[model samples]
Target: MELRQLYYFVKVAKKEHVTQAAEELHVAQSAVSRQIHQLEEELGVKLFVQKGRNLQLTPVGQLFLKRAEAILADLERAVIEIQEFMDPEKGEVRLGFPHSLGISLIPQVVASFRKQHPNVKFRFKQGMFPSLIRDLVKGEIDLAFISPFPREHEQVCGEVLLTEELYAILPPGHELSNRHSIELIELKDETFVLFSEGYSLRPIVYEACQEAGFEPKIGFEGEETDTIRGLVAAGMGVSLLPEMALFYSGTLQPVKVRISAPSVTRTIGLIHRKNEKLPLVAKVFHSFLLRYFLDYNAKREQ
Candidate 1:
């Protein structure tokens, strides 16, 4: 019932070792055990059972753990909200981005945003599409940059910044590498280097190839854009990558040809929790990013 008891229970549940949890909490081992026991006594339920040297959560413990974690997270967010509300311009924004955007897009936006709001702080998390979404929904991150923008999620809302083309990246000595633009079908017979199954880009590329009347033969699969580009540059296979990943790609330069026929593209956007208020600092960042990309895309069109 007490905050400290819930905190202790959650930590012990996660680490599953009272001694280790106490070590991390910077508290005495006996104190941690006493608090956990008090918590169980108050609830009249055994939260954990000993298994070998570790503790395993019982079914009730598992359910209580979720609620305890959520309560802690809500309290943390409330504290941040109050702090940010005091001075929105000087508050912190927790932003999440995918690996694909880390090299160029994110850095560019963050650098420019900092120039305008120098005192504003940033906490960043770089992850894949699913992880980013998970963090956003869980309130772990205030806002996130997502691609192939999610259609409709019950717990999320998003706005597309702009759509960017996906290029066919060929190894240096490939036969059609000289062409400025080529059809997706042109690489049908060539082995393809692609993102692994769970990545957002994988499905987009697959559907593009299928639309072009050939199932791509994936010769190599990778989760990182740099890895995929390296594979292509090393003559492992060709790949379709977003425009941003190809910029300033040191030494390992894959030949980036335009995907003319299918014109593969994906939407890049910002997503946040649905029906929830973003912290003041996050709201400022969210607005700034929308305007920034809007102007960016407008200039590109002009």
Candidate 2:
């Protein structure tokens, strides 16, 4: 039976009088009577015993009345749960970001989001861009912050979260360390500390140097951001990194460089699959990140 018909049957059972039930439901007495009759016939059971001007519940009607109340209670609760998800102040959110953000930005994003939505719980994961993209498409991740794409992968949507400047980090008192900028050609003779193969920035870093007419002397490669930075600080060699990376890793005292190459930029971003529907929590976190980083950029630009 339709939910509306069930509702009428329930109200009539409660009032035990067709006229009073209709008054409470704001429906005409005849409409309420007709709806109950339809529900009883649809259920193939006689739900009421009729006397002069009042009704009593049949055995079947007593059982059904209880079930109907429960159904309506569940329906009411479903509506409330949906509204909570839409409210932004209550929902479960899952976020994935690169290790760089895991250290610097995600904590602040979590703390701030929690202050407003104390009830919402969050799950955070850190992975490289390729791995995070796979998780997003596979439905294992709701939202991601990642490095810029190496190639346009299928079925993924992305927005640049922040454009960060790259700096050439070097040991204290190194000859070129005090300079505001350095040309790639000037470093041709120097050994370079590079991130190990498969790190997202490798190709871009190498290619930028090639365009500047030199292939860097790769002396060492590292797996962790801090390890690479420490190698640079220890006077082992110099390296290049996005400014956002530097903020989380104070392993080295870094130097700012006016990188004089066309491909001398870095982007951290929000990513999700194109056809994926974000859980309400993920959407809130995504929007908050966009605003948080935008606010950061505004202040930095000023």
Candidate 3:
């Protein structure tokens, strides 16, 4: 039976009067009676019996009424949940970021956004750049903060949020620690502690060194930046890391020297599925980040 028929039957069963049920439903009594008769015919069971001047529910009617009430209630709740999902101020946004950014940038941005949109919630996933992009493409995340801005793709798009220079991390007493800046070529002969495969930093640094006419002699590889930084601090090897990562590194921080003579830098950006329409909450947060980074860059320039 149709939902409308079930609706009419339930109302008539509750009121125990076809005429009164019709009045409450804003329908003619004959129309309500016809729908109820149609419902009974579809179910192959009589739902009501004549009881002088009023209607009485049959045993089958009582059972069906409970089920119909629950179905209608569930449908109403589903509508409300869908509406909340479309509400910019009250929904959730799934955000992704690389471990490097998660250490500082993502936390700071999310905290500031929460202050302005208190009712909006967030789910965060942390991974390397490649993993983050995979999640973005698979719809596991609404937006991601990734480095190098990813290559052009038909289903993915992004806008660079900020560009940060890369610095060389060295032991406290290393000879180059005294220099204002060092060239990538100078590090060619030195042992390097590089990011493990799949990190965007690895390729950027590798290509930069290659462009400088040498392949870095790799001493060790680590997935986390902090681990690589610690290795540098212990004089294990040298590494190129972003400025933001250096800023947040605490007491274990190694000496960071600027890279010069064809300096290396990387771009961080917000990426998402190109054709997917973001939920209202995610769309607003995306715009908020664009503004946040613009203001951040303006301040850095000052």
Candidate 4:
């Protein structure tokens, strides 16, 4: 039976008067009667009987009325929830980023965004560049913040958010600590502590070292920036890291110096699947991040 017929049947069952049910439903009395009659015919059961001036429900009518009410209520709730999900002010956004950006930059942006759009919830996943890209491609994450900007792909689109110069983190008492800036070549003989192979920063460091006329001698491989910083502090080796990485190194802060000659930097970008529609919440967040970075870059320039 049609949903409209079920609705008419329920209204008639509730009021127990066809005339009043038709008036409440804003339909003609005959139309309501015909729909209810159709419902009874479709179900092969009589739902009501007229006795004197009042209508009484049959035993089957009682059972059907309960189920009909529940179905209508569930449909109403489903409509409301769908509307809220499509509303830009509500729903959840899944975001991905590397460990370094997750430390502060992402948290700060999310906090600020929540102040205005409090109903927009967030789910975050932290991974290296390769993992982030893999998740994005598989639809496990809606958006990602990737470093050095990802290469152009037919299935992916990216916009550069900001660029930060890479710094060399040395042990506190190292001789180079006294210099205002150091070149990558100067550290040619020193061992390096770097993120594992899949991390974006690892390749950036290796390429920069090669550009400076020597291949880096990797002494230790680490998964987290904190661990890498600790290794540097323990004099295991020096490392090249972005500004945010150094900021969150906490108590294990090593000596951070700018790379002077053949300066190296990494670009952070917002990336998502190309031509694929994002959920309303994710789209709102994507717009907010674009504006957030624009304002952030302006302030940094000042």
Candidate 5:
């Protein structure tokens, strides 16, 4: 019923031990027990049952825990919103980005933003495409840098910052590596290395190949950009990689061949909840990215 009681119950539920939760909350074990008992009595349900030395949430308790956690998260966001509204320049931005952007795009934007607004802080989380969109809809993140940006989702909306081309990554001694640019159909017969399923890039590559009239023979599947690149470098198979992932130094690098005919590409952009108002800091960073990339594209044109 009380905020303190909810807080105590949630913490204890997660840790599954009153003593540990008390230690974390910097309170005595008895105080935590008293709060949990009061919360259960008010709710008229047995929240937890004892199993050996640890406590486990009952079926009803598991359901209550989800609601309690959501309430806590909402309250935390409300506090952050008010604090950020008071001092937008010094507030924190919770931003998500895919692994491909971490090397270049993300750092570029963050560095430029901080130069003008040094006090503004950033908390970054790197995720795959689906998880990025999932977190955006769930309110876990304020804004996300996503690729092949979602267009028709109901809960979230995205804006395209820039669309970059995807290139054919070939092994060192492949027969067609000497070509300046090759068509998608040229690689149709070649074995391909691709990102594992659930990655957005895999489908792009698959569809591009399909559009070119051949189902690519996937030779290997990898989770990371560098892993696919490494597989290609080892002559395992060729792959289609975004421009960002191709930046690497020293040896052990795959040959990057441009995809010309039926060109492969993906759009990079930011996504946020459609109807909810963003915290002031998130809005500030969001606007900064749009302008920064505007100049970036203009410079690229000239």
Candidate 6:
């Protein structure tokens, strides 16, 4: 009739006596008998025969017993598997991030996390932070490494993992490339290539330009950071890029620039639901990111 009934039937079949089965199972013999009768009624088949204080299985009972064993075994294995998943040390994490962070900084974080936890697997997806954050809020991704700007959005919490100062990217042999630090007002008249709308980094750069007292002169718009970098290297335009993007491009060296007006800075970090609990894999990755950036900071200080 139910799992309990099947369990009782299996116990009775194993012990071959209702009295002994009830003794071993801590139930009254009458209850066991009632459960068996209810099971028989439910299945429309008699599964047991009583002979002189002993119980024997009917032909149908033998067949049903095999099925019962399989069912119980499957149930037990399922419980164990679920428990293993809940254990946290083993499992897969679905992670998402923006292209800038994914290409620039996340690879080192992933490498470090893998060394610390080789059994854990990370599934990485690259998208703009707004879309990635939407997925994170909807339970689509377990963790996200991205730059945060929509800071007051509900159901999302972010920690500042690293502070990447934005710098100017210029074509090789460009006039600006010779400067140690270019000011925001310096690029006022220059064409600026940037990531398309909906990118997280756009506002940071655009706002800096605004604070510098002008709207950005948009020449070409793109989505991916690498493409923007490539365009910048070709002298199509210059972009305010995180230092990480420079490492990834390996083509253009980001020129150090000081924008004293607004002091442009991007906070790269892990994002997740405000109330949700992070899995063990994500927690480990978060810790790894913290340490990765801390070590990076120490090295930079040196």
lDDT of 1 by residue, 198-269 (tens): 788999999999999999998899989989999899999999999988886477688989988987999998
Best by lDDT: 1
Judging by TM-score against the true structure, name the best candidate.
3
Error of 6 at 277 (Å): 2.2
Write down the TM-score of every candidate: 0.73, 0.67, 0.76, 0.75, 0.73, 0.70
Question: What stretches of model 6 exceed 4 Å from their correct place?
Answer: 1-81, 249-262
Overall local distance difference test of candidate 4 = 0.90
Model 4, 1-302: lDDT tens digits are 89999899888888899999999999999999999888889999999999776678999999999999999999998997677669978777889999889778988999999999998878899988778888998999999999869778767797999999999999989999889899889999999999998888999999999999999999999989888999999889999999888775266668999999778999999999988998888899999999999999999999
Each prediction's whole-model lDDT (CA): 0.91, 0.79, 0.89, 0.90, 0.90, 0.81
Which is the better candidate, 3 or 6, if ranked by lDDT? 3
- Candidate 3 lDDT over 1-302, as tens digits, reads 68898789889988999999999999999999899888888889999999998899888888988999999999998887678679999888999988889778888999999999998989999988778878888899989988889768777898999999999888889989999998889888899999988888999999999999999899899998889889999889999999888755467668989988677999998999998899889999999999999999999999
Model 2, span 1-302: residue lDDT tens: 68899888888998899999999999999999899888888899999998778999999899998999999999999988687667667766767777766656788778987887798877777777678888888877788877874336677877887777777778787898878787767777878888777677777678878987888999999877777777888888888887766764344464546666444777777888787677777787778778887898899899
Q: What is the lDDT of residue 51 in candidate 4?
A: 77
**Each prediction's Cα RMSD?**
10.9, 7.9, 4.8, 5.0, 9.6, 6.1
Enumerate residue pairs that collide in model 3. none
TM-score of 4: 0.75
TM-score of candidate 2 relative to the true fold: 0.67
Q: Which ten residues in a row have the lowest lDDT in candidate 5?
A: 79-88
Candidate 5 vs 6: which has more lDDT: 5
Q: Higher-TM-score candidate among 2 and 4?
A: 4
